[model samples]
Target: MTSIQEKIIALKHKKNALILAHFYQTMDIQEIADHVGDSFELARRAQTATQPVIVLCGVRFMAESAKILNPTKTVLLPAADAGCAMADMITPEDVKRLRAEHPDAAVMCYVNSSAGVKAECDICCTSSSAVQIAKSLQEQRIIFVPDQNLGAYVASQVPEKEFIFFHGFCPIHHQVKPRDVMEAKNAHPEALVLVHPECTIDVLEMADFVGSTAAILDYVQNSPKNEFIIGTEMGIVERIKQTIPQKSVYLLSTKMVCYDMKKTRIEDVLKCLEQDIHEIDLPEAEMKGAYKSLERMVSVR
Candidate 1:
């Protein structure tokens, strides 16, 4: 093993740290991670981890989530500057203002948001659980924050619950146009289109399957078909290749890359493990408040 790889492994053992990487993370980071998954899956794994320190090989919002889920454990984001546009799109004040406009509506926040936004919302949800969470809420009107695409998708599924969506989207996924999906399908005629809910409605309409990153991975693994056109971040293609090398998978658009997710390199992971700086620290009250929404999400699942 190289020095960086050897040192990271050594430090992880020494610090009792478990590295959690998102599906969008680079292949190197994913390979070194003790657990590699999407945001919701990583958070779930972090909750059950026996390690005292958790290193997140993902974006800032993901690290914040790990901190919220494991308050007692130290959560570190290898690339401190790595942040999601969707997460930064809304704030606590914005949620409050929207809440005022629709007093009877429940606030259901996507997990791609920040700790502060989660604290303000009534309940938090992931792409996989959004439809169920929104449906479970007794409120007829729901204010879904920080991703209109996901909100719209969930609203379509649970039509009984009316949704007031927030104007936010993943900068990377937003670039994907419907024509791109068409072109990809034209090239790979037999391939099935699998898309994430963050994708635009136009792209979603072209998809044969719609779900979260974890859900997408699971679909590709279990499906009888051997070919797919993935409609999310590009990193997932690498992940799928690793998991099921025999299957053929193609990206709907090459522009589906998330620079924020790629920011956390193997070098950053090694440096983070060695220095142990950039630890995620939420105020006790902030953490406690956010935990309620997140905890409620888990309970429903």
Candidate 2:
């Protein structure tokens, strides 16, 4: 470890802080994180944290989620400006409007949304739990928000329900076209294609596997196949290369990078711990509202 990393560890211990990172974070940040996982996993970790201070090494929405889960704790976002484009694509007003139009439908907000949006929804879900959550809902009509791609994927899995999708999407994942997958496949014909459900339905249809970042990692680690094309973010590809070196892993597209997730450096984490900067604070009402949706998500089996 570098001197900076050692310093971060020392400061974390001094401050009684727990560092949580998303799977899309840089390897350096992940190395020092007490827990590294996808959104759902990190939220669960945040909820169960024993420490008073929590440093989240991902985008703003992730830090917000941590704060919502652990309202009493100090949740610090290392990169204050690191925001999710998809989260900003929709608003509480939009959710209200959708709910009015589909009164019979239950609102299911993706975790990739603002706390305000979550407060307005009936329940929240992450990519990994979306299908199960949707299936578990009592309402036959579901109004899924933020990322239409993920909503569509969940809808496909639970065909018994009717889904009303929003126009929002992950700009990075939405950029992947079917031709891009075909090109990658042609270059590595023997490689099995693994993609995130955040991709468009057409792209996901071409994938041999569709899962969250953690699920993708687990699949690659356990699968008997030796060669794979990872879809999702470039960080996952780097992680795969580092952890599963024996497997020949390739990125499905070079354009799969999430700029927001890449904003936090190891140095930023050190500064966050030292100064406790970029603390996440939400209105009490919003926190309580979002908590209901998120708590419901966690309670799902």
Candidate 3:
């Protein structure tokens, strides 16, 4: 019998598929994947791929974006319910309401959101590129929807730009109190701290480095310190462990796992690859509208 890894490779060959996995996916899945990175990088890679099948072993919005970018290609999510709470924080109706209130403001949807929300957006951005994309816009006012923490971080960086903030955040990160930082510091006296910018300002302030999942990995792999405390999801910790087996890694807190992301497992990935179930779909009109926003984001940097 073929192992899951062998099955994944064989299935890829049979389907002419490209697996664009998120850094948070299982190590085995990441190892077998054609590419692994954060949402924007994965989407960028998926957009440029010649493969007819895109197996997105990540959250729902990510698979949706793959389909949005490559409409003709078949995009499959390992688990249909692997949703994002931050993304769910806002909806198309929410955008419409916001737009109604600020008629002249451009709406910048985080790529973590749904296609329906993307359809209503002027552009989309990932954590790494949000500031660059927002700053590039000449608009006097921008509605940065669905991620209040991310919006706040971008706003702080670009004081020149005006932003209308949303009241949403990642619950996992939201749970990370300022006290947690002090506690982690107290416990790991020698460990350098790295955090996601999605974290609250208090956490961001204490971080030795701030970046996306891929950037976090790069930081650890290249860092002089062999010991570190990570402030993101446990999947990141797993990635660091696999890539830098020589390093001693620790989580800032045990409270950071995203249950939504964890919903998709290696078994689910192999099953999806085998059966091609839970295919992602988007309307041509919706795709066209969402594509403009996504394309605009890519053109930013």
Candidate 4:
């Protein structure tokens, strides 16, 4: 029986492929990936890649974004079902309705959303870049759609600008209770608490550091503290452990897994690579529209 790693290496050579993974992917997938980052960083990397294929190890929307950016290159996802619930919250129809209500506000969609939703947006942003993107827009009031927690977090950071938020959130991050924070703090008083801004405002308030997955990785790598509590997905703990063998990492809660992110496994990835099946396609017209939003984000940042 061939291991997934062996197959991945074979596929890389055969197809001249680049595997881009998300932080929420399994440790095995991360180990096999050529690049591992959040949505924004991965999209940027995909845009400049010389490779013919981009094997995205994240959710469906992420692969769709890669397809939108690198229209010429073939983009494949391990599992078509791997998706984000937060991204699923808002649709193009929902955005149209919201725009009808507030014609004056410009839509700033989060990259985690579907391509159809992104096509409706004036610009797009990730958790790390949301503040900067929101600040760049001075033309009109901003309606930040999808993840309200992220929207609120960006709003707090850039209070000079007002953001009208859609009532939506990440279920995994939203489930983190304040009591979990207190408990983790009680257990590891010296450990720094690194959090994802997709968490609720109260959780953000309790965090010693509130940022994206990439930012959290950088912080843990550079922080003076030898111990930390991570408030994102559980997969991150494995990555931290592998990188910083001496340090201790804890999850704020054991229930931090995103089933959607976990849906794609090693076997699924290998099958997709071998068959070159389940390709993600963005309509030429929709790609053009979505790329405009994405480009506005890339150029401004």
Candidate 5:
């Protein structure tokens, strides 16, 4: 191992720290991560953490989620500037405005949103559980926040509910066009198309499978198919190569790279461990209230 990596490992042992990484993290960071998954997985991991410290190797909102679940534990984010456009686009005010306009409808937030926004939500759902969570809610009408594409996808699945969407999206995923899928399909006819629902409906329609980053990984792992076109972040391609080396995986859109996810490098993680930089802290009320929606999501399934 490199000297720096060894130092990082030694410090982790000394501090009893847990590393929670998103699927979109770089390969080296993922290599050292104790738990590697999406936002929901990281939050779930944080909730059960016995460790006193948590190092989140993802975006800001993800670290915030970790802090929400592990309030007492020290949560540090490697990259302080790693922010998601979709998550940062909306605020608690927007949630209030929507609620004011649609007083009867319930608020369903994607985990990609800010913790403060989640505090005002009726329930929280990730891309993997959004369909089920939305379906599980008792309200006839729901206001889905942040990623409108994902909300529309969930609405398509559960026809019984009416959805009011907020105008926000993952800029990386938003770059991918339906034509991109068609082109990828044309180029790799033998490969199956697997896409995240964050993509536009047209793009998703062309996909052979539509799910979250974790679901995408699980799908490729279990599928009998050999070659596949993955439509999520490029880091997932790194994960696929590492875990399922036998399978051939290709990125559906070259534009799928999330700059924020790439912002945290190995050096940043080491620095975070060394100096405890960029610690995430949310107020007790917000953290506790935000967790209720997350809890409801867990309970529904």
Candidate 6:
């Protein structure tokens, strides 16, 4: 461990703080994190945190979720400006308007959205739990928000229900064209194509496997295949290469990196722990409203 990492560990222990990180974060940040997971796993971890202070090394929305889950604990975001572009594409007003149009449908917002957006929805879901959450809902008509690509993917799996989708998408994943997949496939004929549902349908259809980041990681670790093409954020490729060195992993597209997710550096985390800067604050009303949706999300088996 570096000097800075040692300091972070000391400060974390002294301050009685827990550091949580998303899989999309840089390796250094992930190394120091007490728990490293995707959005759903991180949110669940935040809910059960025993520390008084929590440092989240992901985007603004993730920090907000931590704050919502643990209202009393101080939640600090290392990079305050690291916001998700797709989360900003939809608003609470848009959700309300959609609710008016489809009164019979239940609203479901992706965990990538803001607290206000989640407040307006009936339940929240992450990429990994979307299909299960949609299936658990009693309503036949579901209004899915903030990532039409993921919504469409879930809809395909849950054919018994009807879905009304929003137009938002992950700029990074959405930009992946079908040709990119073909090029990667042609280059590595032995590699199995594994993609995230966040990618465009055209890209997803060509994949041999489609799942969330954690699911993809688990698949690669357990699969008998020796070589694989990863079609998500670049961080997952790094993680796979580091953990499963025996398996050959290749990034399906060079454009899969998320700028916002990479904004948090090792120094930023140290600064957050030292100064307690960039704390997340949301209105109590918003917290109360979003909590219901988030609670429902976690309850789904």
Ranking of all predicted structures according to lDDT, beginning with the best and ending with the worst = 6, 2, 5, 1, 4, 3
lDDT of 5 by residue, 143-199 (tens): 999899999899999999999999999898888998898899899999999999999
In model 4, which residue pairs have backbone atoms overlapping below 3 Å?
Answer: none
Clashes of each: 0, 0, 0, 0, 0, 0
**Which numbered prediction scores highest in lDDT against the true structure?**
6
lDDT of each: 0.90, 0.95, 0.88, 0.90, 0.91, 0.95
Q: For residue 238, what is the lDDT in candidate 2?
A: 84
Error of 5 at 213 (Å): 0.7
Give per-residue CA lDDT, model 2, range 94-180, as digits (tens): 999999998999999999999999999999999999999999999999999989999999999999999999999999999999999
Per-model RMSD to reference: 1.0, 0.6, 1.5, 1.4, 1.0, 0.6
Candidate 3 lDDT by residue in tens digits, 1-301: 3387888898899989898888877677788888989988998998998998899989999998998888889899999999999988888899999999999898998898989899999999998999888888889799998889888888888899789988989998878987898898899899899988789988888889888888888898998898898989888899888878999888888999888888888888889888989899887888998999998898887
The C-alpha stretches of model 6 lying farther than 4 A from their native spots are none
Model 6, 1-301: lDDT tens per residue? 9999999999999999999999999998889999989999999999999899999999999999999988999999999999999999999999999999999999999999999999999999999999999999999999999899999999999999999999999999999999999999999999999999999998999999999999999999999999999999999899888888999999999999999999999999999999999999999899999999999998895
- Against the hidden reference, what TM-scores do the models get? 0.98, 0.99, 0.96, 0.97, 0.98, 0.99
Between prediction 4 and prediction 6, the one with superior TM-score is 6
Residue clash pairs of candidate 5: none
| Cα lDDT tens digits for candidate 4, 82-111 | 889998888899999988988988899999
Candidate 5 weakest lDDT stretch, 10 residues:
292-301
TM-score of 3: 0.96
Q: Give the TM-score of candidate 5.
A: 0.98
**Candidate 6 lDDT trough over 10 residues, lowest sum:** 235-244
